[model samples]
Target: MPARARLCATVPALLPSSEADLPEVFGLPGRRLLAQRGDSALVVQALDDALVPSGGSVRVPAPWPRRRGTWAVAPDASLAVFAGVHAVRAVEPSGATRWEVRHGCWYGACRELHESYEEYADSKDHRYPEGGSAGFSVDGTFVWAHVRGPLAAGELGPDVVDEWLLLDATDGRVLGRADAGAAAAGSFHLPHPSDPRQMGLSIGEGQDGAPLRWGRWDGRTLAVEYVEGDLTLMSVSPSGERLMTVTHDQDALAVRDTGGSVLEGLEWAAGTAVPRHPDAEPDNDEALPYWDWAGGFVDETTLVGSTVEGDEEWGEGRHWIIDTSGARTPVEVTYPVTVGPQPPTALGDGTWITPAKSGEALYVWALD
Candidate 1:
């Protein structure tokens, strides 16, 4: 049996503090972070893999005005890009514009592209469109961007059939692209930590089997090898050989190969069958457990799991360490400090990170 480690909370000394209020802290790959205050997003980097923040902060002109848009940073942490209403825009550290790509917008009645951010933000539709899931690749060489297609049928027409594009990180030029042949309600990117040319795009259709598109970019052509159905990919293994996903309804956590074959499946009901707390569901009612929507690999075999379900014993949520190397077994772990109630994101490394609601700092944990 594996025992849980009680990790202590430590704030990155380099993280900038807003005098008025704590700014929003967002974790990026390569142990970097962003502190957002209204229209400005301050990009900060970690001094070392320990995730200790460094000195300089770059101010980025946030897209979407409010918190309506999500941003991604390039490899060297020089360029920052945000998903716009009908396009993706890359900006400099000084909040200057670099380039923008005009993709399709979501207004069904109006197929025209959005000229300004205000017009697109005003629409009450999917603020983040079915095709608005955009982010840069692992190596920061290309950006895998999702754009809405023309309106179709059966599932809202071509709009459901989104476009996945690979754009040059420097000029925002389309290098390779493909049509995601599914009704994507939501989507995300999973970049292979080791392989820069490979990545994964997951599209959620709000059911038991969302489509997972595995893409291979071989310099010239950017193509999807196959579409794996029925799983919401959370993160790829550090080795890039295996990828992890949550069951359609959060009933289980599964690991699969690059071919989309289920290598291991850890059912929540089976793992949480024995309740550690009195507030846990009764033995008979343990048919379902609310698994955190997002989690990441600590190394190649260990995973940090979180859940919003809790009782008087647990504050807002609970964290668990599940060994995915073999024979799935879950051990509950507790944080030394409070970081509010929200799903924690895996930082590709061995860190489990969550944002503080106060927007000032991040809560991070490590397994010993």
Candidate 2:
């Protein structure tokens, strides 16, 4: 089994401190503040204005006993927390709290929000025996979740059945639920660029012969749209105007307009390959595709990604700048550290923030 790594807790200097009783601190994009008092994590924001903790501190209740998961920050600066057995709560900027109407089901699942950072829950009737995963809409208003289903009387091989669910982020209401039948493994939620109420679902095999399924959700309804290859990496553009997905054998990044129509398709260079990092374990199935780690869009035209070449550790990881103009090239940026997870996110001003795992430190790299 792959060793588990805990997320670093130390807050970087760029991130406001939780120690002082101060109201707020100015950081990169806005004024940020954090408070941890009486079993709650409070996040406050003041952007392009005077910093004040009095107006925006969101107090999140503590997790239930025996289970724990990570917390996610929404695009609008809200807090989405999964408290094991308790509930998933969305603490809004106005300090309003809304609990998942359906609780006690998503006990130990990977929960995340759309851009709005509202709360959502995956399918609970069918649970993944070992690990759980989920995805959200771009606006944070909707979610699509998958859970492993029960086995047959004399089943063989890994659990072959699974379930898919569409949820309303506003109230934890189950909008639609479906049993994906056998050979179904995982599902991802991709938001539409122009429509906040619509999202796309990508379901596929986990490791072996699991079938890949694709569908669309229009808030009030769910429908299977396409069933194709085994999808590996899936991402939607920041503007919610485009969707990009990659399969195992071939890679094609398709651009879809707001109407769910394919506008253009870019095929990855046939000979290019993702390289394996030295620290990755030999049996790690998740490590196969290097492009899986490469995501984030600087704009509608400029997309940033990481590329790996071979099993042998050779050159430093390459950053590729891709665009609709059809030219792909590596941009030069110095990576401060050579070890650990190297996930990078591009900031607004031609710069990127890569957080270090060991400490409360983040390296700001300016792209020249």
lDDT for 51 (candidate 2): 24
Alpha-carbon local distance difference test for all models:
0.64, 0.43
Candidate 2 lowest-lDDT run of ten: 1-10
Clash pairs, candidate 1, are 23-359, 152-157, 152-158, 153-157, 209-230
lDDT of 1 by residue, 295-363 (tens): 777778887766665333333566667776665677767655666566666655676766665556666
Q: Which has the greatest TM-score?
A: 1
What value does the lDDT take at residue 176 in candidate 2?
69
Residues 208-268 of candidate 2 have per-residue lDDT tens digits of 5323344466556666544444544345565665655555543343444434345644545
My TM-score estimates for the predictions, one after another, are: 0.82, 0.57
Q: Quote model 2's TM-score.
A: 0.57
RMSD of each: 4.5, 10.2
User: How far in Å is the alpha carbon of 270 misplaced in model 2?
Assistant: 6.5
Ten-residue region with minimum lDDT total, candidate 1: 150-159
